[model samples]
Target: MDGRQDEVAGAMARLAEGDRDGAASVLRAALARAPDDPEILHGMACVARASGRADLAIGLAGRAIAILPAAHFHITLGCALHEQGHLEPARAALHVATLREPRDVRGHAALAAVLGAMGRGAEAEASLRAALALRPADAALLHGLAARLSGRGAHGEAEDLYRRVRDLCPEEGAAWANHGAVLFALNRHEEALAVLERADGLVPDVAETLNNLGLVRMALGHLPQAGVALARAARLAPEDARIAVNRATILAELGEDGVAERLLRGVLADPVAAGGAEGARAAFNLGTVLLARGDLAAGWRFFEARTRLLPEGRWPDIAPWDGVAPPRGRLLLHAEQGVGDALQFLRYLPYCLERARVVLELPPELQRLVGTTPDPDGLIASRCTVLRPGGSVPGDVVARCALLSLPHLLGMAEPPPFAPYLLPALSAGAGGGERRVGVCWAGNPAYRFDRRRSIPPEELAPLGEVAGVRFVSLQHGVAAGDPPFAMEAAASGDWLETARAIAGLDLVVTVDTAIAHLAGAMGRPVWLLNRFGGDWRWSAAFDRAERPCWGDAASRWYPSLDLFRQAGPDMPACAWRGPVAAVCAALSRWRDGRLAGD
Candidate 1:
């Protein structure tokens, strides 16, 4: 080879060995001698990119492209532009690279990523498909496709693709991680854990896989293990905000609010976590902890970040409508998150109805469950006019907001008053009871904070001791394991059956899970069992400390209900026992008329 070619090859070798500084020095020396060498310029760009000097890389790549107009140089420039967040320019450069070299899978894949970030899923999917066609056995291409499908809520198809990728490349850590994520989304916690564990073992230092493992462990009620995994992930990727946020979430569950707050603050201080989805998560988590600590204003500000935290294309593209609607027009309100979230935020429907003609889009499951929510003018329906996977309002609607944002829009300082809201049919043999008391010892196990919030059935045995109270299990679909406390188990066919049983009861006591939110929304007298770091909604303090522990005992915002909190995380069982005893004693006194009724 000629001397110049020999010099370029040496620089390329240094870059390949991850010695960016060495590569840069060699490239600079070659460029000084042969300042217009296309190969040397490209080599300099690669070194600059490896060293995190994206702008320098862009300039160098531009020079190389000007000299030889090579597709590879355009790909290098695209990558550098992407790093600088010049997405449109990066996309244009990637398009030129693909045009110059149609068979270049890497160029196509880079373009797919840029298109996906721009919310052009259809185009991105097409690009990914083209890349896959060129390199059918490529594990990275399969994983990327699976991720895109998963982001669009095509879980079944995504799961199939993930499994296929894993089968083909059993040792690929990213494939296993993707598989775990899909399983977790499907609520297969055990399978998720196994998959994540496999990924963790294969690539022990990958921060993303470790984070996924931590999430699964948390879901399975393994708090300490989850904490360890999350901590390790944070340590491995100190600059990654998601790892820090995940770690903080686990800490909050462990009731270490002080530590969680500090970690979240530290993450927010990093510029990378300041404006996008990561920033939103950091803000939301930080707000949640603050709200639990009773810092309302700051908590609400952070809470607002929830909208920004959604995946790039998941949120509605339409602008939020001003409260003042066009004459004779309607405002669309859509649900986000879980059923409990929909119910909790439904309290704002009445206020919204007062301002505009309201149409609410809800989960199909809750369609009949929340029939005519807020009554009269507000129309509640299962389907939207323009149904999109991630919630979206109608194009014709002047404005829209997520149901959870109603409280903020309504200018409410505190949660609206509670009343006996949803009234599903009572089950056979549910009524005619002498002060029925409903109970739910556990919650959805998939929740990351389930370990802190849910109690095992065995811990609820104390409630069976309460005199004049007919304690009945209101948990439905899921099994209620044997409780140490003596209580009668009531069989339920569905949520309606559970609701019917709860209707018969004078009160219901549950953990800070969906049931607690359901009971509260139903305007039932519900004694909510809360952990030290409870969810944002339950942080609101209420009155009426004594009541039937069931269906509408006190009228003052379920004035009939009460709140029982664990004193600390070390021994939550001990703290919970005292509240159970107190509740039992109160029920006995109320049954005896020792406490006068209003």
Candidate 2:
């Protein structure tokens, strides 16, 4: 090799090894020898990028490309421009680099990155797939494609690709960590935990790996272990607002609300964080903590952060309806979250019906059930039209608002009137003479925090020991397991049928699921099994006493619902033993009371 070429190669090696000063020293000498050599200029560009001088790197790379028009020089230029946030220019440079050398993986990879940064995800995936076709077993290419698929919610396909990456590059800690994340998204929590732990072992000090480890541990209800992992991650990446937000969430779960609040506020105060996803998360979490503790005014304001967190496409196209003056024509009330959220907010429909001709959009499962929602004078039936998804919105619907936004818009300091807003759809002789108690141990698994709220069927065994209470399975979607207790009423059917069954029951004992909200709305006695740091609807202080103290407006929103919170922050690692036991004791008292009356 020529001496200048050899010097350029050595400088590239130094840059790869993270010795930017050594790389610059070699590149300086090589540049002096051959002032116009594109190879030496490219080497200097690499050194500049490693030293965080994206502007200098872009200049050097441009000079190299100008001198030789090499594909590699263009790739360097594209990456430097991307680092400088010039996505359009970066995309142009990378596209040129790819056309100059279609066989080069570096050019394809760089181009894909620019495309992804430009939010052209489909085109970026196509680029990665094209590269993968050329080099099918390339670990970096496989990992990149897998990440894109995972981001787009093609988790099963992503998991398969991530598996291939693990096989091709067993020592790649990043591949392992990402594989774990896809598994977690697929709701394979145990496998995800194992994979993340393996990743942590492989890259012990990496903040990302540790953060993933913390999340998996938290999912498994191992709060103390999760805390340790997150603490290490926070120490490693103190400036990372995402990591700080995650740690604060964990602390909130552990009942360290003061510490969590401080950390979240600190994150919110950082301007860079305030402008991104992390800032929105911090705001939402702060709102949740405040609402859980009954700080209503600030809580509702910050709780609106959830609106900011929604994807741009999810927003309604029409202008928002301010709750002040009644809409001149029609008001559209839409469901933005889950069925439970819809159920919780449907109470406000009557108020809107009183003002304007209302259109309520909801999931199809809710259509039949919503018919039974409280309407003393049948105003809802007369004035409101229910729209299922894909059902037409009338062109004259002048203004729209999210259902959850009603409380804030109405300027509610406390919940309006939470008396039974839904009527039971049953006849007089529906339930048998015995005291039938419907029980649900799980919610929809697709919920992001389902692991925290759901209980294993076995955890309900203690209730079996209670005498005279007939426990019926109210759980749907999940296969009903053989519980230690006998079910007096069988489980099955659509949400309306479930509502019929719940109406016949003497009481409902349920985890924090839609059923709990349904029964509460029906004014059935509801024993809500709440996890540590439960949903904002159940005030955090609910766990303090033998029976829930309904001092907070959040809790007061469900008058018929009684909470059985996990005993302490330490619980749930014990797998709902405390709450289940409390439910058993409460059920025994209820049964005895009923028998005495009979």
Candidate 3:
């Protein structure tokens, strides 16, 4: 090679070896000797990009591409443009690179990232596949592909890719974190925790790994441990809005609303972090906490931030239609979150129907249940639409909204006062002179915060001791066990059957689970048992006191239920005892009143 070409190659070698400063110095000296050389200009651009000077990088790359329109020059220019948020230009540059050198994995990968950022999942996936085809064993490419797959809800494929990445790059903290995230998505909490812990150990100072560790711990119901991990992560990466948001979520789970609110507000105040989806998340969560505390006006305002909070690709971009008049076209109400969330938020269908023709896209499991909802027009079931596939809906719908956001739109100032609104399939037989009470002691094990929210059957023994109240098991799955109460497992059928059984009972009592939501929806008197830090749905506006007695708590979208919270982390058992006894006393009083009338 010529002397100049040899000098360029040496500089590139230094860049590859992590000597970014040395690479920049050498490239600068070479650029002085050959100022307009494409290779030298591209090399200098790369070093500038690595140093976080996107403007300088873009200038250097543009000059290089002008000097010689080569694939590497285009690729370097694209990288700089992508960093500057010029996605379209970046994509165009990457396309040019790929056309010039179709086998270039970096060019394909850059295109994939830009496409993914633009919310074009299918195109991104295709680009990612093309990149992987070129460099099949590249760990970074595999990680990117796995993330895109996970985003598309292709957990099986994503998990396999994550496993391969973990196996191949055992020392890569990011690969371990990604693997743990997939495991967590699949509801493998124990395994997820172990993987996340390993990742944390591998990179002890990494804030993201520590934040993930906190998330897994929260899922496993280890509130204190999760709090500790989150706190450490927040301290280490104070500027990382995601870590702050995560820490706030854990605090909310622990029922420390004051502290959680403060941290979340801090995140919101930082414009740099707040401008992105993470900022929107801080806003959305802040609204949830505010609403839980019964601050109606502020809660709704923050809740509206969901439109901006969601990361691209999770949901479609649909304009928010004001409920003033019927929409000019059909509106799609897509389900977000879980079955219980769909059921709880279905109350908003009436409000939406009042405003426009509505097409309700719900989980198939809840199709029959949602069908029972009394909607005069425009409620359609989403059948065979690939939530697991990167499928897109027909673009004809005028507007779209997430199902969970319905409650906020309906202006749920307090729990809705409607009871027995959701009727179950079971029949209510005459109580044999005893107050029949239904109970669910657990929640979905897959919930990230289930450990802190769900109570074990054994932990419910104290409630079983309530006199004159016949407790029935409303819980399902392996989590249910006969615990010395008048209990029957929900019959096999649909949720309608479960709803019917709950309907027949005089009252339903449950921990933070779907059954509690079912009972409340059915308008059956429900006394909901809550963890001290309870979900954002239960706390009051002032004093952080637990809200029990339907009307006593703030009015909301679902209002037939009362909340009783365990006092603190160390005294969860003791905290619940008083509330259980109070419920027993209330039932006794009702019984006595009936007898007196007779």
* Alpha-carbon lDDT, every model: 0.74, 0.82, 0.75
Indicate the residue-level lDDT of 135 in model 3: 89
Pick the lDDT winner: 2
Q: Residue 216 lDDT in model 3? A: 82
Worst 10 residues of 2 by lDDT: 545-554
- Model 3: how far is 441 from its true place, Å? 3.2
Question: Runs in model 3 with CA error above 4 Å?
Answer: 1-141, 307-437, 456-473, 476-487, 491-496, 521-525, 540-564, 570-598
lDDT of 2 by residue, 1-598 (tens): 3888888888888778888898899889878878899989888888888898999999999999888999889999999999999999999998998899999988888889889988999999989998998899998899899989989999999999998998787897887888888888888888999998888888788898888888888887888889999999999999999899999999988888899999999999999898899999999999988877778777877888898898425435877877765636678788888888999888777776766788888888888888787777889879898887687888878888888887777777566666787785774455888988888888887876688888877677778788787778887775356454677555466678888888899988888889988888888878888887667778654223333422112246676777776766663548588778767766776777732123
Predicted candidate 1 versus true structure: per-residue lDDT over 136-186, tens digit per residue:
888788888988999988888889889989999898888788899898887
Q: Candidate 1, which segments miss by more than 4 Å at Cα? A: 1-210, 256-259, 265-272, 310-318, 324-328, 364-396, 417-430, 445-452, 458-471, 480-501, 540-558, 570-598
CA lDDT for candidate 1: 0.74
Ranking by lDDT: 2, 3, 1
Query: Could you give candidate 3's per-residue lDDT for residues 1-598 as a string of tens digits?
Result: 2887888888889989989988888888887888888889888888888889989989999998898999988998998899999999999999999999999988999999999888889999999999999888888888889988898899889999999999999998888988988888887888999999998888786787888888888777677888999999999998888999999998987778889899999988898888888889999999989887778778877987876755335444776555444436667777767677777777666666665666567666665665555433433232212132234555655777777666566665654445444654556453566677778877776565676677656566666666767777777766775453546555555677677777668877777788877777777777777776666666655222444343234224355676665656644445456556555555566545542123
Between prediction 1 and prediction 3, which has the larger lDDT?
3
